[model samples]
Target: MKKYNLYCIVLFLFIGAQAKAQYLQDYTGRPYYLKTNDGVQGNPLLTETWYTATVDFANGKTANAILNYNLRGDELLFKNPKDSAVLAFVEPVKSFSIKGIRLEESDQADITFASGFPAVDDQTNKTFYQVVGDGKIKLLRYYKKKVLESTEFSSQIVSRTLVTSNSYYLFANNQMVKIKPSQKTVLAAMNDKADKMQEYLKANKVDFKSDVALAKLFGYYNSL
Candidate 1:
């Protein structure tokens, strides 16, 4: 009876190990090529440099590796070792961080993050948002890529142009809201502090349309 029990224990351990292995293997995404265009404004990556990342899946499983994202295709690609294939994370990813950027998946199949604002709603839709600033109030940026076609006329010649548009968002009152990258819209969204914010912007010569400038504004607001 003792021998039989020992064998059973070993079998159980083996099964557990196999299950873990299977889980990892199942989440490995297949590789594919991304479509290219000529008029894309910036590099698809948030940063040109690669960074180590921790990817969390919807099933509560996590994986660690070097990762990069292509905004144009909304693809999360990773490589584990020095000589591994760079594959995309085809599975639904809850959130992941590369370098210092933390991105979360939204209900609309978008990625979002905490804007350091107070939660005011019970909505559970996960939207992808790029957290630009985190403090008492948070600044968020939403990136989107759309294929645009334009015709150019030259000396008896015609050509087509394709470009991508990048959008921005603001997180406040426990919600992520899209807004134009302009002073009026941004200040309106922050109506409670609009007057003060406007004064601060003018004092600091902040450019509301610039991502860097917007991040600086949020940082200053949190400081106050």
Candidate 2:
């Protein structure tokens, strides 16, 4: 009898705790986003919390983030559930920062393309960026044939880097990842020009290494 009473007490406590605990909920205050293992076309379903977050896109599209998490302005991550038809929430990220691409010279052409970090399932904690579409810049994780997370780049930005092929991408991660050799060339040319200014410095050597003018020259060079 005592054992039964103890069991009852424990069960009651469990129920009470569950009632008080906060499960992940959608904007409607319902747990509609907790669909486990429900995915379409082999894409994983979104499931669980700590897997998505609210993100603000440059285009004014806001993903409440049922499965998507914005890693940055250029990168996004999504976590899919194990094996159900119902997917979890969606996540959107901005991961276009230039941290994953490498630059090379193509003598015949004006630009070159290189594969960048794969946009993996952010929910699964896999590779940095997993490729979903044709463009390296495309990192949209889909579910039920829907775009859960997408990377957006405006036309002006694309035009700046799309001179060559898509193997080249634009990133804004602030990692100092150089994506444009032409930009680098322009910077190098400016540096060379600054060095040549040494002749003027001989008579008016304003410490080109530390002077504001010299620094500005180098800064201008780097901007290219």
Candidate 3:
């Protein structure tokens, strides 16, 4: 019996080590970014600061590293201390969290502003989204990137501008629903308690035009 128990413990340890080995095997080093000399003004990254991030890969392995995300290219870059190499994380990362940043969305006349969101799913497509809130209902912000070209007046120099469009989503009952940043749309998304929420908004004088206000409304709805 003593020998049998010792064998079982060894098997368990081997399995645990294999799991970790498989997780680390998924990561491969790639070029950080293609060199670019364009003098365009806009950048997809919200800030230039590198943040400590915890990345969960699709293979059920997680690693903690200092990371930065390029919004325009939809790329995740990591600096590995072992080799001191700035390499792009080529594995399919299921989700990652960076410190001191929260994904937020705002709408202008014809444009939407999104920041601090990294794509968690659909890794092959290079689509990026961040989870702003999660509960019975999950709030996701999707980011779409576009390049705009302009010519200078004097030198006729062509420049490329990176623009991003952000769309908000509400996930309930395993269905993803798109939402506009407005009172009507938000209430519609919360159809379960639309009437009551509408009343709450009125009583509280909520400004649906504001993204922060709209997110707060969703947060409250999820709580209830």
Provide TM-scores for the models.
0.55, 0.20, 0.66
Q: For model 3, name the residue pairs that clash.
A: 119-129
lDDT of 2 by residue, 65-150 (tens): 33332222122333333332333223323322222222221111111111234343332322133222222122122222232433
CA deviation > 4 Å runs, candidate 2 = 1-79, 84-91, 96-224
For model 3 the local lDDT of residue 135 reads 65
Highest lDDT against the true fold, candidate = 3
**lDDT for residue 66 in candidate 3, whole number 0-100:** 69
Top candidate when judged by TM-score against the true structure: 3
Please list the residue runs of candidate 1 whose C-alpha ends up more than 4 Å from where it truly belongs after superposition.
1-64, 90-127, 135-137, 150-162
User: Whole-model lDDT for model 2 versus the true structure?
Assistant: 0.31
Q: Quantify all predictions' global Cα lDDT against the true fold.
A: 0.61, 0.31, 0.65
The better candidate by lDDT, 1 or 3, is 3
